[model samples]
Target: MPRERILELRHRGRSFREIARETGCGYGTVRRAYWGAGACAAATERSG
Candidate 1:
């Protein structure tokens, strides 16, 4: 749920800090979620 929210916020052009604040997560947490999900998506796209 949070990963999706984080991605949504990112897609809306929110910075990591803003995402963290909006989502009530730490900056590192938001960054990790965004990058981790993004990496997975990229890998899936490449493989697919």
Candidate 2:
């Protein structure tokens, strides 16, 4: 699944397990995606 879709789902209050199930990904994948994206966003905010 796309990162944007995953983030959108997460923004809507879905749990990691729920996102994994809906996106056909493993729980770890969903969790890592969220974390990785957050880290990138934080880095960008700090730099920008």
Candidate 3:
């Protein structure tokens, strides 16, 4: 459920700072997840 936890934090509008604190995830990890999601969406749009 690690990915689900990340999405929940995202939906709650938690800052990367807050998510890091709450989830004990590194800042880079949280930020990477966020940006990676955006990149996936962008790639999808380009392909479509």
Higher-scoring candidate on TM-score, 1 or 2: 2
Candidate 1: global Cα-lDDT? 0.64
Off by over 4 Å in 1: 37-48
Name the lDDT value of residue 47 in candidate 2.
36
Q: List per-candidate RMSD values in Å.
A: 8.8, 8.9, 9.6
Reference-based TM-score, model 3:
0.55
Q: Please, what are the lDDT tens digits per residue for candidate 2 over residues 1-48? A: 556766888889999899777656678777777876432233234435
User: Model 2 Cα RMSD, Å?
Assistant: 8.9
TM-score of each: 0.64, 0.66, 0.55
lDDT (Cα, tens digit) per residue for candidate 1, span 1-48: 246767887889899898666656667767777877432333234435
Clashes by residue pair, model 1: none
lDDT per residue, candidate 3, 7-40, as tens digits?
A: 7778988787887666555677777767654222
Give lDDT per model, in order.
0.64, 0.66, 0.60
Better of 1 and 3 by lDDT: 1
